[model samples]
Target: MRSKGERLRRRRSAGSRLSTGSASELQQYSELLHASPTNPYAPFDSKIDWEVARWAKLRGPGSNAMTELLKIEGVCDSLGLSFKDTDALNRMIDNLPGRPAFKREEVVIADEAFEVYHRDVIECIRALYGDPEFAKDLILLPERHYADADKTIRMYSDMHTGKWWWNTQKAVERETPGATIVPVIISSDKTQVTLFGNKTAYPIYMTIGNLPKEIRRKPSQGGHVLLGYLPTTRLEHIVNKASRRRTLANLFHSCVSRILRPLKKAGEFGVPMASGDGIYRRLHPIFATFVGDYPEQLLVTGIKTGECPKCPVPHNELGEYGDRDKLRDIEQVLNALSSITDGNPLVFVKACAAAGIKPVQHPFWEGLPYVDIFQTITPDILHQLYQGVMKHIISWVTKACGAAEVDARCRRFPPNHSIRLFTKGISTLSRVTGREHSQMCQILLGLVVDVCLPDGHSTATLIKAVRAILDFCYLAQYPAHTDETLNHLDEALQQFHQAKHIFVLLGIRSDFNIPKLHSLLHYIASIKCFGTTDNYNTEYTERLHIDFTKDAYRATNHKDEYPQMTKWLTRREKVLRHEKYIKWRVAGCPPPDVPQTDGMPDPRDLGSRPHLRMTRHPTVKAVPVSTVKLQYGAQFFEAAFARFVVQYHEPRWTAFQVEQAAANIYLPFQRLPVFHKIKFWIKDPFHRGLGSETSDAVHCSSIWA
Candidate 1:
């Protein structure tokens, strides 16, 4: 039997253990904690109430307690804790699972200086690997193919299952035997920090493709991490506009190169990193995809604006549909960039122009191995499809069919639970979102169905064109695809192109030189290489800006806010990680396993069958039938109710008999319960998981005659 002191010592040591590791590893962690006292999850006194610290930190930024840390002391004092001071609480908050610190660096590009706040990419990658939440779902090796019993390639659902990952995996294995490829996905967007301000933040986010798309796409899942904040400062110091643009482009590359410099060595050679499963694997992180809008894509790939970033398709020929020109060659681009080394600016400019690229020397991907910058630029559905092509289509349709007619048809259209009513029509609406465009797509073809086209230019062809484009948009977003679906996608685009000449003949537009329309040609290729469009959709990143940029900025004092924003993000991440850790401990620290279904039917598999729900309590209980006819505008209510009753009683009743019975039958009740509205929750096949719920009012009133 052990003595009381020995037992107490063992208990204290157990409490101090931060991770599930060997005694030597625990000692090493203890040493590291002591060495870096500011490290979150540092050792704390046994007497300190961790429950209080968890509550306080979990409040997150913009919380009342975050604004006033002193209030937490008061709460602790009320609880009569041993450590009730603000300083102790601060220490405890700092002692949660911490994030990598941001390093502020001054980057000078062509005599212009700017500040860039960034974290180490390798450190961030390792941190993600260490996360238990991510590790369980992480795909360490690429899935070559998943075939049915008949040996047919059936499912292409994730990036790992795509051709790019499989090909890249094979290449990496050939170079470094037994090496695992970690596909790094990068996204950046410039956003306003405040509602009314010149202040802006250019945030760059990074996530690995190892995680499942469902997890990667959700901001709440914590799959995405803030890689850095690029300088938003406009170079007002440079007098020449051309020079400024060149300098700005160079600065972007410079900053990105600095942030991702570590990956050069790490990608070529493997790094032994522990995954969420607590097993160390030799992982090689490589740049696989760059998710951005058109402008950002141009910036990353050094392509001039109004040019295709993925391929060498001429600007004039973008609208022409056939086989697209071959993809941009990296060797030719590098040679053009290298022209500057000869000390001839004119030669560099001409060479870059000949190569159809911006005059950007030493792009971010210059030294990165196995990274084709042009191919890495993924298709953006939100921008290119919905906002771009759909917007243009709507404008052309409005011109072909007058706005008044469109709006009139829109207003008169019957309301369905799933479709937007467009009460005032889409013509008057300004700054429509991708979501709105999608809603419009649902009814766009219907609105122009029977409408007369000016000059008798074949309204049937117009209808076909509109239908084809809508089909392409919906099909492009499928969560899984096969060869058959890819062919269908191709046919949809072909159908639209074949019918698009009506727009030109109608004088809506002279040519189809639109870049967004041309981008449609590459969808099949991109989907084959990178899986579904949802994997790299900018919609998820736009959602991320709310939490990572906007909320983080709001938490700050609004002066030199990047530092505070990064720190706040770090603290919030720590709090969340610690919460998970605590939960794991409580659950007996079960070994990490691949996520298994609970045998319940997948929410995605729930078909178009709508689930109807009505309030148990009636809106107006025992309302007189006369009031329903007069006030509720149900002129035929009494007759309709009688018919319903007759139908319900007599299954085989004739129509003539039902009408006669409805007119003569005496009503059972003078007053009846009425419900104002009913909700229909119907599954949207395009969107997986939770179905959409829309309400339809029950009224006899008609908006249209």
Candidate 2:
């Protein structure tokens, strides 16, 4: 085998030949090649190097190579067989290249201690930029305007297509010409590490809008980076309840501010970075969006639980919808926070309460440029819509129409290919999820069809209100939206508002002062500013919790697992990045080229045309016709098969002729092939052709019934 130095020289020579696109790109690449710790690839030159790489690649989920080797040794000892030593494995892993260490910082609030673990934000950004896999799908510039053949402006679909991106691009260009705006998206959520225990992890994740949403949403793609894991403390040390809450909020803001401090200067002064297209650009990393559920939103913005995070709407008037209130001004909030300088906690709390915010000394977004903290709080379909609004609607409607009757209707509802069958009814479900709420929405209106209401209330009005809310829910989730669809969305909300008083008259709800209901009023404005709801949906971030937090925690011992989890995550990332580098080298490290945009079929243009698909092998190779009828519940199988045969043989056959031919026709084979399920794929009309394949399966097995 070649020596390590020889392998390094050969790899560098080959990489140098790849086109750099410009002088800036060449300079950056040269620096990366010579840098001590920032080099993109590691040289595998010996038997031990190959062994380590193989071990990293073959490790199982929530496990390391060392653990697996130890297990193997135990099994071999039991069988009287010899096994190799694991010291070499451990040594090789430790010596692996390009592994960044985590920093542990101790934070104190209200005389209580907490731990915050994090990595360098700028270093993480550079690592992501240097990855070759992202280069294939990176979107570097804003798509300000795009029109169709009819000259009609299309709806916003991607993050770059939104007005916020375009406005920020223009602003940055004015300040520093030829500078690129990198839209940074940050998300954080607390998740339980174990199923039965109270142990939990609060992880902060970061990604960029420079990548396509299709790529950024998938956790396996490594597009979403784990910035840090915050301490999950209840702060029981503080005796006063109010003081404890204030201290917890302050701790959160302080930890987040520390993690994101690098962006403050980088957002104003451009940093030189190499783009996916082999071109160097002066990139300004702006904090453009924050994705989280309602509780996190309140915590991040320093707002109380009952108030709107995006606007100045009063808590009591949230149910009354009409003209939108003014947006929360950051400067005004800061001034309010600074108004009381006596350092008295009571006076500070009063000043913040007057401003409708919590007593947070400094919010995470205090110094970030071109970012409206309120606007950054995006719409969450999971918590706000499905879990929040839909849950309330179900409860109100069930009470008004009687739960027994609704449960009977739900049990009697037929099975569908697209909609889930809630066999036990939704009334008894303890903790319903967003997915269950979605399935319930499909059959909600059907359950109340022509059903009478109690108290002589109008059933039509209830049906109308439910229908309008469902319409709004479905429309708000559209992958793409236009001027016309946005108007329809507004109309749906207005219709709901006009018909919502039926619940009050029926004594189901005293008032409509629901914050979730009020949130619907701002969907149009949010969509216009930040593209569609899916761009920052909390559902994607919730999915990331499994890979980034829960799984990482599982790979560690119960005591002080934060450091172990962070280190495991770093090693996993390094392994994946090195795999990508090896693949690129094997492919000859081709120069990056501009993506072809013309002549590509637009997904929106392709209407809802479904194509049937099935397995290549038959589910049942030889099942008798009689068996199919008796076991599979196909009572009219013979008649249906005869009619199909007659229609296939004779065009425009009458029913009478079909019946006559059915009597004469006989089975050519005693046994017939059976397929248990069939799938249908329809092209989605949004988000271009990237994520447009909508599929549903129909199972024909008797057990499914």
Candidate 3:
């Protein structure tokens, strides 16, 4: 034997490491003893230490070298096995890896194949072959050799197969446009590498060495090697297409599933696909279909859509990494967290702390408590904060129209979160504050415009801010303010469009450009264009801060000037219904409560619906815009106001609003939103009588609904 071989031989026969038998006898016995448990030495009572020893001896000295023979005896016996044939000897050898370790082996990884060297791996195998039984039962996969230019070696194996795994029958499971296979999982890693695509067609080959000296020393070990090759590229093509055809709701339902892990509260939402990035990335393709375009950017998940910042930072330690892959900081932070949690956490308080992962004195920790009214904030705290922010913004705006302080506040707040909270405060307090449209527009304008667009933030982060702002505008009950906010918005939007177009245009990334942004923008334009005070015969729409209590509609009773609140609410109901219908069609089913209409039209495919044409509103008109419906809208609001006050017992809304409502919803010159327009009389509001007929006769409109 060569020097390395002699060292291994000397080490193996070290008497303390190997059994009393010669190497051949030891190998033979080890193999028999460790043979699949079904062939256990059924002659002894496993509970006896002597019986366990006898069984181990019976099993042979092959590779089943016993170190802590007693510890593993219980496990072996339960598995219907005697200790003679054991994996213990292999493990004991590994516990001492420094003995001539790293000697080159018959095991060589090259040319898409692995080899076992004559001197090393073979010697290890020879040591393992002391017993005939275990040796006969075990066989490493054959070497890979490409027989021709087109031929390639492929291999596969999985452990712990459950009922879901094998059918002896290989079949394709259908998801969107094609059939796919979800293969059985074989191992566990803290952060797993998930390979997406149809698992059935993808061959995953793994190799494990029967070496006794290696596994115990290296805990971060790979028992197997993985291949990134697939014979056909067809799996990629099919998976991509199927993902593109799915709806956001359905796509989420299809590819990824969330588990209520025992991490936080009653549970935490754990990403099931964490073990494999390939599987998680497939989620992006599905979201692409929802946007009607590829997403330019998307967070890794739980960043925007998840419940607050509630993820546990793992055992991490941060580093000052000069490289661009910024995860180094997170890694260090995780290690510190692990040290605190003692490597595992099962309860809520600890879970929350783990999720926050903040060191006791971190600066960001203080502001987190007041983040939202939804989680732990009491009603009192919520009310106080709401009032405080609104009042504070107003006082600041009044005192510092051009003050450097005002500009500084706007600049200091990141486009993320701080601005979103400001916007949410504005929207929530609109009914209470009675702030003027024009002044509100400018304040909002200032915030959106002040963010110095920097490569300093992720593009995904910027898009989130933009989306939040757009949603805030819509929810504030002020669709007509869009064009008014236009110039401000266009400038803000320019930052996102110009710099992000490259990725947004390509299908490669999916962090930016989701459906809600564009759809909400489009709706804002649609409603604002048609709903104006021109119909109310009021010219004050152009003013910055017309006090609502002092508007012309108060004197006019605004019946003739604004659209009815009843009409507007009725229209909103329709939009909701239409959205519901679109969701169903995409899911290839009917929405619940949807009556069989024999041939109810698909909402998303409604390209042929005949809508009454209203050409009166001039195209391209901006804020406080006028459309033909304004003429009839004034009359509409008068009727709507009378209707609203009587039916719902709602407070006397400012005449300013009554007039705006009339111009927006009731007139025939312009129809309400689509779902209502499509089946206006068909859908009934909860507990309300049929369509506008009864509403018209009673002079009652419902703002509450």
Candidate 4:
């Protein structure tokens, strides 16, 4: 006889093949996508899920961690209507896996890790129903109803909470000494029988649109699934707690009466068990920025190799000139991912990789992280990869901070002073304790700049970072990565017109002195007003931080700056294809217009020495060519470095890339051959923070302070 696992795998494979034929049945499986979503379909885009799913499949077992990370970001972006950053992502990652037994193909989790333990239920269900029955039931599963989000337990027909949800009154009635339904609905998505005192019935409700593709009448093969089940009273109590609504306040704009669902005494959904994991996450947004593990020196980009030179793993497998081992480790982790029947597989393999114990070392423990073997592995990789786990950490952090609503706690719409409070707190904390302002700045910017996108414009915060730091200079420095940062930047830029003046008020930007940038901004407005059709709502090139809603908001109010930009317009630049910054895709080439040498030319100083400085330059025509865009996943740092070099009479182009499979992307400027040519750059280990505002201010401040 095949082992139980093989039996289950065989059953699932057949079930999948059977289920694939019917489009309706396949469509029903999408509920699984929404149930345990990596993100909500933001901007009404379903492709994001496919992108996330593709990433997960490619990354292997580690892909689940990536999946969870994506889910956290997607959840935050879709639900809160905000963004996050890498620092915030790290904090959130640390908070997960708080319970036990995690997996990928969850039907429902009936225990401590009910939130993630749905696969067990699914497995049990598959075992109960033969492969065909299992496949058919998946077709009948409900379409993901966003309105009922708090209702369903993602993967499992009814996760533990789902079981409780299905048998809510039954669980209440059974007060029965020991009774729990072995989820027939879970193990196989195609089946829907739950054991209620040996009488199996499809107790769960199903919505109209999402249903099984095929309907099966015969029970076939094993008529009843036998589960040598045990009932635990302690677990029963826990399920009751887990059954509590997920963010009632968030879900229901109107408050629910205490009589309907009693609130926990601690005023939370659940109480802390041992050490509360996310205190850092909960508090850090208020404090601002995380202590990022920014390496003091270059990452061992295959030059030094990921292997501990002496430890003797084959270093050749990892590509030279980059941390290919990290990539290999990432791939290895993805491949090994099984459901969390044991535990977090990503963390498990990560520990192995960090300790130099490759896949061959713990072959059986490939995708599952069981404590027996996992305990033996070193925790360094598990430790380092935490940063990459929660993608939009910053946005969540800002929200959590705002959730405190400390400044105007009870108001319907609080002042939303989270950023200002964080900045003020940092200033206060730094001055009183003589904390290094640079370090403090680094933490804040790591969350802000490194995490968020579109650098430093008012759109930095997912919790509306723009309105909070009105008229501030944009903080454009790269900080640590997290989930919310990129999401927040995208969302904020989507609503750029709403955040613009606030950025200016914060003095984050010098109003464009060149009419070219202004005209570009105007053209962007016109395109927004008109339509780019294909790339409509695309986030690139024309993303401006403008919020037209404010009562007192106004443009920079200087025609001199506006009209003066005519020169840049005159530069014969028709470089429109960089909208998505695609290289090979677009046709035609306009020499990539290097940013003009002039600094922020004030409208007031316009025809003065600053103005004369531009026209009166020695007749050296133009400077010699430097480098072109080498491929990079990182553009923020290189973009800044490129401009920095020209200011100090230096020239170099830098590209960013992933390092050691770590969350942090490397600028690798110092690694380039023309590294010496980047004279205008700065290292800033101490911390001014992320984005243009902090970059401009702290660079100015560090020079002064």
Candidate 5:
């Protein structure tokens, strides 16, 4: 066993050498933890109390090692094990050295215990096993900080965001097109006012971790990481338009400059960039911008457009772009924005000037890849669809739509037995938000022409047009239909434009004219060119900021918040790295299961279809027919057999359901019951695709005709 001082010295020495790639760093950290007989990095051990206590004291005041010892003792006692006697523990606690006074008392004393733990234990591990220059990379002292400044911040690098970008980039590159280099998608949004209690207004930008697989896939999963933040208080100081514009421009420039630094370095060095850069382009500039509201979009692009920002189409008030496909030119838009002059000073000049300590640039026009800017800065689906169009339409229909009684009107689809019967099941506008309204749109659009309205009359046609626009929000599940979906959406928007006068009858005019409503026409084109709405939307970015706001609020010290934030973020990285290391060590190749089935289900299948069954299992006498939808790991079963089994249940049910069922049953079930194990072969009569494939009774047991 080593003394506390000896371990500290060892960690400090080893920490310096951990400046390598993630794998090498992990290995080095693992080796350092194993250097001492009692590894501090490992799960808690009561036996190492003296060393642990001493380590805590090194962190700062307020960490009573005695409390930690007590916690360990309590855990041991709960497990019916004996802990070191209280007298011995007291002796150890009493002898522990006093907490060291780090220059900043406020920073050392965290508002929460987790902060303390992160600062003490996690940070020590990070310092020892992680990037040694993590803190140094963000903070600059002597030159930047005041003479008396205990802590000063130059910048903050969020570790989780970095890791996510790294991991996601790796996955995408490895799994998808290896040669294609996608630029980072940076999403910015103003968080809820007072989201951080006293720290009310924190507007932040984040790096999206993953790219959606295809046009239909939503890029909402895989948490986005923060790249930059601006406090509203800072904005309040720039009262005059010139100063305000300059300050905002500076803030945007500095933040973007930092983000682009790695890529820029890569460009200079002729090396692939850091944090998931590709060989093709060393500096993949900001190609996509996802923003919550219109103001942020204005800030990013520095210009408001009369037409859709994405396509070469002219904007129409009725949510339609006629046969004209003239997308706005990036250069033209940039010229328009740069043309604005305040007292002979061009806005561009003021924006790019180094008026403050840091230099500024037009983040979108100047900072972005020139060719990508046109489609890069477009409408966010979250605000445009749910919060914008859906919200507006619902509010209008329920409140001001020329219906005598809102409830009675929405509840009944206007008359004619010749038309489709409308389901009055949609809730009142007050009860549902934009997401729900989009879902309703999906259901309404799927109805047959006669079923959608009272008659094939003009009123019914108008209602159909309205629903069609909402239906456009849903990206088609299959790639083949995506283009068709976009075309249909365009046609629907055109029809809406032609018949928008119907909304006037419903007393909905001004609301229909919002740019987002018109911009919805471009989503299909975006998906066709870029990917899913998630690929460039701010949904994930906004959600991640909620957590960041909480973390920022925890650090009450605003004077040197950058240092505190770096520490917090680095600690988080160390924790995630440790977890990932453990996972890699423990994880084996995933047991062979089913190949993912793509595309829409075969159109031949009808409702209440018969079930398919599998024939074999190593453990069970007969595998369940329900297992046909699951991944088969049986050595006796061939890959073809596995695919056959999976396809039988999959097109009828979703691939998601099939995978989920595999996890639920195939992964856990030791053996299937005889009843579930019953197997048979079912053939499709409609398609005449005669197959000798197996079928299960268990799956179709519920679908008795």
Candidate 6:
């Protein structure tokens, strides 16, 4: 009898053979490309004639295996193209004399290059589908789209750099997530044109990043690829040549409107435009405007103002504007945009030149049929929070305060006990807070407890102000509380501005200006107007670009970088799709659930403590409180140095947990003996508050008073 391992191997081998045989059978159903029966080695262009003949000779005379696959009837068909058997052809090509290289001189025109790729990309897109839930619901219509453009330099040589890109959308649903489908490349032969406020024409390059279904079928078998490049061109190439003023908005409108016109027409088709493999996608107009960053928005929209383009108030040079009398509303913003004369460059330019309020010149957004400036522009939350405020404030805190605290404490303790702040700086802050501004408020409150900072200290005040804004972001979800939160945030902002000299007092430089520190202010009003902070956030879009950057590191050809990006995107999508399919299969037939284990009963029950029912859990027995992590309403505090004692667990209460405690349990970290009951939402602690002690007893308010 064969060994069990040998029997298993034989079974696996038989299964593989069966699968391969079935795949071949399925390929027979493909008629277009597979049944063409043309010579595979035939060359379409004279440029590859020498290579073609060598391939024929390598296959040996009359073997017919090396016949040009391209010339095969129906072989070029989308369905047939995917099923082509390239093993024989690949083997033949591998034995050729030298590796293939790009012939740049033979490159097609940018417009022609874009069309060839766009046609195939559109075909592929038509085959895939979007989340039906997102498409059907009007509320979710805004969620289905995000538009942002970024330029990355592709080096052909040390001195020669080219840029190209195409607009595309990625599908995200719980079941089949992260499917990036490429859209058409919007490029033209006349790539450069001067726009309003520009002295020269800016060159245009639109490269669609998508991979053929054939290539994407099995990405893991080989190294990842980045191959779908429409063409390469430069932005500054035309800008450098133009000697007259050009408006960026005009150029964007002229180019994009033309591109969208075709797509707008395509949306009328009743048949799901693109459907295959049980997935379908629709070509629809984008609703949200999620651009790369503030500068890009300013450039693209022809709005020179550094403040948010949608702000109703006239933002100052410092990008700071807040008026109690003139709170932001859609009506006021529309009136301001309407003041800019349509198509009259002189009038718009003169309006922009005025100091207080500048007029928006973009014809595409400002007074377009039903759309208003408020709907067209949105503040980038990622840049405002993570890259901007969180990063800057953390830097200021570390340099001016955290470092001092660390140094002061380090010398007093042993090397092992030496205190250090979060080593990753703002990144650590971001990870802890994430999208929850309330959680950030918790972290900020922790800083006070961690460093033993007094409540009235300037640094403490700054943190408070920062937390106030974060809390506003967190609590803004409640429509009833939105105005209240905004008011609190305004107060916090004022306090922070008043304490500007505090940074200097803490040894920060004198040149620190409030305007530079106030970029976060622009996002607040917009948040109230938009109903959520996520509406304008670039967190997802920026993350996608980050993935692109990381994948680009694998590219060997610096000159032709677009193809590498396309290949990476395709491979990533394929991997995600395969994973989704596997998950779907598993979901249909779920594994048996593991038996549940009984957890140890509360220790108090096993012990002689008959009073355990008085509290949710047992309170630590008379132990000194090393760190008092307390929550009172939305307020959260984690104090490492503040001292108190575990008197008793306060019995469950509807609104508050009052603890009667003795002060100065630890001499160095002592606090007032006056007992207090902390009030906070009950559900909050379960979600975020971990390792906190339940109050042992109800504090007597009258006794403390």
lDDT of each: 0.77, 0.75, 0.26, 0.23, 0.40, 0.33
Give a tens-digit lDDT track for model 5, residues 603-671.
Answer: 223333445445555333455545533534234333444455666767686767665555443333534
Task: Tell how far residue 247 is off in model 6, in angstroms.
Answer: 7.9
Q: What TM-score, to 2 decimals, does candidate 2 have? A: 0.82
Best by lDDT: 1
lDDT for each residue of candidate 2 in 1-705, tens digit (9 for 90 to 100): 222223322433211222356533223443443423432333444334443445543354334454575477355354332223444443444455553467999887766678999988877776566555566676666664444545365567788778788678767766766656788999999999998979989999998888888777766556788899998998887899988888888899989998999998998987777754465666788999999988899999988888888898888999987665358877778777776577787887787887789878877888788888888888889999999999899998889878888888889877688888877887888878889888899999998788888767788999999999999999999978887888899999999999999998998888888878888888888888788998899999999998888878877887889988887777666555445444344445543332211123333333534478789998888888888888898878888988899989996989899889888888787788998888888665665556447788887865434
Model 1 segments beyond 4 Å from truth?
Answer: 1-74, 81-88, 146-154, 591-674, 678-705
Q: Distance from true position, residue 634, model 2, in Å? A: 9.3
Q: After the best TM-score superposition of candidate 2, give how far the Cα of residue 579 lies from its true spot, in angstroms.
A: 0.8
- In the range 182-244, model 1's lDDT, one tens digit per residue, is 899999999887889677899999999988888888665677889999998678888999888
TM-score of 6: 0.43
Residue 137, candidate 3: alpha-carbon lDDT: 26
Q: Write the per-residue lDDT of candidate 3 for residues 452-494, one digit (tens) a residue.
A: 3333434344344344443344333321233334434444444
- Error at 336, model 1, angstroms: 2.2
Better-scoring candidate (TM-score), 4 or 6? 6
TM-score-superior candidate, 1 or 5? 1
In the order shown, what is each candidate's alpha-carbon RMSD? 10.2, 9.5, 31.8, 30.2, 17.5, 20.9
What is the lDDT for 188 in model 2? Answer: 95
TM accuracy, model 5: 0.53
Give the worst 10-residue stretch by lDDT in candidate 1: 9-18
TM-score of each: 0.82, 0.82, 0.18, 0.17, 0.53, 0.43
Among all windows of 10 consecutive residues in model 4, the one with the lowest summed lDDT is 280-289
Q: How many times do residue backbones clash in model 3? A: 69
